[model samples]
Target: MMEKADICHIVMYPSPGRGHLMSLVELAQSLLRRHPSLAITVLISSPPHLLPSIIPYLSSVSSATPSIAFRHLPPSPSPSLSSAPTAFSDDPAMYFEYARLNNPNLYHDLSELLSDSQPSQKPKALVVDFFYSVAAEVAAALRLPTYYFLPAGANPLAAFLYLPTLHKLTTSSFKDLDGNVDIPGVPPIPAKHMPSRMLDRSSRIYGHFLETSTRLAESAGLISNTFEALEPRALKAISEGLCVPDGRTPPVYCIGPLVAADDHISKHECLIWLDSQPSQSVLFMSFGSMGVFSSKQLREIAHALEKSGVRFLWVVRYPPPHDEMWRNLAIKPEDDPGIDEILPSGFTERTKDRGLVLKSWAPQVAVLSHDSVGGFLSHCGWNSVMEAVFAGVPMIVWPLYAEQKLNRAYLAWDLKLVLAVAESEGGFVTTDELAERVSELMLSEKGREVRGRAAEMRNEARQALSEGGSSRVAMAKLVDSFKKGMM
Candidate 1:
């Protein structure tokens, strides 16, 4: 697909984990797929580690492509807040530490990349990770165009970041903060629903989150991984108010839900499983890779799911120890049991027909996109929210930790498309509460309303990803920033 073009493209993302890399890879591939003539460069945090020989596919990426190139940049020898894992206690202090430790090196790396790169061609623009505000500064230093790459829809972004601004005006905090806090231009969000870390004055992570948010306010414009119908208000606000209130706020591009189902399989089996199930009869529960839960918690969840008698698809990662029966498989088979090994006995066999317990990774998108999926039990990660919205699956927001509470609030309170489970009475949810909410959300009248709304959103979201959709236009505008200097 290569054609003669003089522009060089430098794509930079955090190297802490695969999530950023995977997202960046997809975007890069999309650009390469769409514009073969364009020169592309990707700067990862570290060199690619050797892929497991047993699983062979990444070689397809490093080996097959000629025009596109991947380069690894060095991060701080010390890991930072962004790299730190969330503890089961749901604290955000660690998050601040990660960002602080990482950003210095992150900034240093971007500056170095800009200063040192000798592209056979000069970069036409600098595309950055939205979370990493330093990219814009780096581009500005060299007078290059910059674009903010947001991984979720604008609704939640506007909802979470503007909480303080809204709180100041409305004399109330939004949902998820704990109790109902009212905000300007937004519905009530609870204190419990607000990110647990945001309330922590002593949070090492919250401070870092605040720092990055400050940088986000100054980015050139937003290039979100969502389409218009998914977040109309957010897109409008971003377009008019310059999107960001505290910073140099730029335009917004909603070219997303950038979903690619064909990327991985052995996953399709899930779809076939759904095909055999009744419509809207199944519940999908998954806490993303990084979320941590105690072994007792895992066992409680296992017992709760079993007691509910609801059909479910649960993705079990390394689990916390529950009983001697669980000790045998305390962790994921690989990666040391660290903690994941405690599960109740007869988990798979007892729930065999009624449930499917998948270890490691399953294609989340494909599963959610299925028709039989009635409700989603989620951690409220931005990516999961996008998938749930796109798939029209209503959520049961678990929000295990981190910014998840805020994300959960957006879906449950602001959008009224999902139900939020509170953790205030106690820090964590027990199995009884988990099953109760699952039952309520998956079968009750309120659940029906949420499901209907979610389905409606799914339709609107799909259209946004189509030709000439608002999201498409927004994406085009962002890409055009490269072709024409920010005018």
Candidate 2:
């Protein structure tokens, strides 16, 4: 092993979006907190609209942790790769991926910046989100150690790592599989609970996913945003190389639940609304930053909220017109008048006393941390799930896209930390079903049982992060390995 350097730095390349950027930022901050002398840089390449929110959030964290800096790269131009899929022109799922595949600017910008760095300031390792398979190639060329940061639990990671095997074992997509697909060392997840992207073998994104998962094995290690107690079985499987052939797998580190702290949480109006509600009385609903629902669906949600009769705080966004694809766009905080037009007639006025509907972004961390929030009606994004667990709040899982369906399965069926909202006939969750689910999560005995489990998990999560705990020890070992040039 090489002698420890006087200064250690890691460059993080976050995929374009709120969730990816936020989780990576949290990981950087966590490293800085644990190792005060370390320096970090977050290389961002997101859509223009999200800059307002993301910039401020990063700024706040930077102010407190001066070792961390950010570099926002220009959004890449349209598909430049000759092999780029022409069919993905309007597919929202491929929005960022398309930008990344087409634009070569990210690699150039990163390389140039690193080349310009002083010898002492040059990063020893490059940390990148899972979407950044290209960064691994860059790191290998530069001979810098690379760690793949998976902003999800080990279960999802294990499932994804085994995609090739799953593809070989079945003739059809996992969604079309007759029964549960039993992943070694992980729970038997129903085929329908797999990610929508993985459900179709022919989709461009599916191919991309498989390639990325394979590329991940080339890295020095994996930094999972999960702890041991949370998914011991999955973590064990991953560490033992059950997800992939032994010696092909990288060293797996479980150092997570790396959720961000809301710095300006005190200023959000939702906190005031939450304060007035009694403990465990309000259900908070917020799809992730990119989550969307049709106008008709929004109306149904409003009616369901009205019928549920539970004190609620709903975070709403206006989706693009019914015919238009939902792009990665932000609804400005100042331009929320259209919500009134999109919501059902008289819904706001009727529920004024019992509900508060926040437009666009809310202090999600603060909202979940609040004593008044009992249950979360979430899109089951891993970050939101982590926050809810840390706050000891159970969830009403309503997965939207990406790995959310997989998360929903783990949370609802595997871990028993949430209640799932059943979709009605024709694949839409009706107002009646929504209302029943909200009521059950808020008022039923099952809700209490789930909440108890959530609280227990919350305690376990807190313990995992404390001194001498699993996360702390894992993170310590990771830092030591990096310093010793062993990772």
Candidate 3:
């Protein structure tokens, strides 16, 4: 064990969402595992609405890892929807604003942290989430080196770095564009298939994203939660400056497959159920944390699952209100309607023999790593995609929001490791389409091919993290750059 005076400290600031927070925490853990002489302090500025769900994970990390500390910044008020912004105050923009509002608190707390530390223990670098690029200004004000940590793959990083150029090339919203948007490294994405947040150019969220993407080049370096073998072309495009044509791109680091640590305390019921199934027999369906569907969509999915006849475990959250007025209400877990209320009548009884439907949450990392789990019906969030990839589980990509569609495009088209589920207008997946996709993913020859690719990538991911591997080498370079105070 290293003495306090011998340790190198680093500060990390993650954006508000659980996915963002979890990814950064995983990265911190990975760093400490490789460099025990390093101490990491994660500054969390959790939004009020998301605080409850984030607390348990925070507690768990704190208890499990003493070297990785967390300091909770004072909660900032949510951006008022009535305050002159367009009727498009989405969650992404709100999270950005929330983080921006905490800049003063961050500066004060960070200053004290640095001032109180021994000279050798002072933070060598400050890492901010991709969405929290604005915090880079605070880091700069403190004369600290800043790095942008993107808890995503290189494909999305390429698209984000290219946003400024894309903005200049088109005047209309992405949804209104006449043709495909050409992004470096990835396949030509249909304008409509762009991230939902980037669809409406006039929205404040799009403005935030554009500004964040533009400022990304100002960082000392970018550390992505991806490896070379997983996204070779995309990483190459970024390294070659194809993503940022107008500016000098910062050094890119490919070190990833970082996922949440599993707390092997007790066996979850879901895992026990998996134990009863055959190897590679169960299809695990889980949308991300904020993934919720309407009642109509729930029924359609129920119908699909029943028709597919595949053994499955599905985590279902309460359906959002149909009325826009009630959509923002904070629904408590205790208030969540019963499974019977949300699903089709008698759906649970019909599928009980071969399927298990969990309410709202499950041990996602453990489930994906289980042998009984074969295919994933996922929202294609970067973290979820990484988890599935690391587990070698094939997927049926059903993206919901954020950059998930972009992730879907990469997974389905570029990587060919997952099958894409087509959605009808209004983003509804019909029973037929969902059933067919599930069958194709679970039983078809194409599914077998995709599975093979996923397994190969999984091996590649393992190798990249092994001793003297590509990701390990990159990690060493990143640490060296920080130690040398290189910009």
Q: Where is the poorest 10-residue window by lDDT in model 3?
A: 81-90
lDDT of each prediction vs. the true structure? Answer: 0.63, 0.77, 0.86
Per-candidate TM-scores read 0.79, 0.88, 0.93
Model 1, 1-487: lDDT tens per residue? 3324445455545333457656766666656655555666766553223123211433566675565566555533553322333331244343233333454555565555556556535556666664455445555765767766767656555654564454455433233244565433334556555555555534455455556566566666666777766556656665665334654555666667776555454646667777888998999888887665666678888888987889998777764434343455543334454322346766777787978776656788878877898988988887888788878889988776556765665667667778877664555778888888888887788889888898898888878766777766655565567666432
Error of 1 at 234 (Å): 3.3
Clash count of each predicted structure: 41, 0, 0
The residue-by-residue lDDT of candidate 2 on 1-487, one tens digit each, is: 3223566767888876566787888888888788876778888776555566578777777788877888877655543322243323345445436445633665676577568546556676878888776666667766678888888888889987888777777778776677888886666767876877778888877887888788777678889988899988888787778888633888888887887766454568889888898998999999987787877688889989988899999999876544232222334434554556668778888998989988787888888888898889999888888888888889898888778877777778878888998875344788999999999989999888998999899999999999999999989887876665423
For candidate 3, lDDT tens digit of each residue in 129-234?
A: 9888899878888888899998888888999999999999878999898778899998888899888888999999899999999888878899998899988888
Candidate 3 lDDT for residue 106:
92
In the order shown, the candidates' Cα RMSDs to the true structure are 5.0, 4.5, 3.3
Alpha-carbon error at 120 in model 2, in Å? 3.5
C-alpha lDDT of candidate 1 relative to the true structure: 0.63
Q: Which stretches of candidate 2 lie above 4 Å from their native place?
A: 1-5, 46-53, 72-119, 263-266, 323-337
> Global CA lDDT of candidate 3, please?
0.86
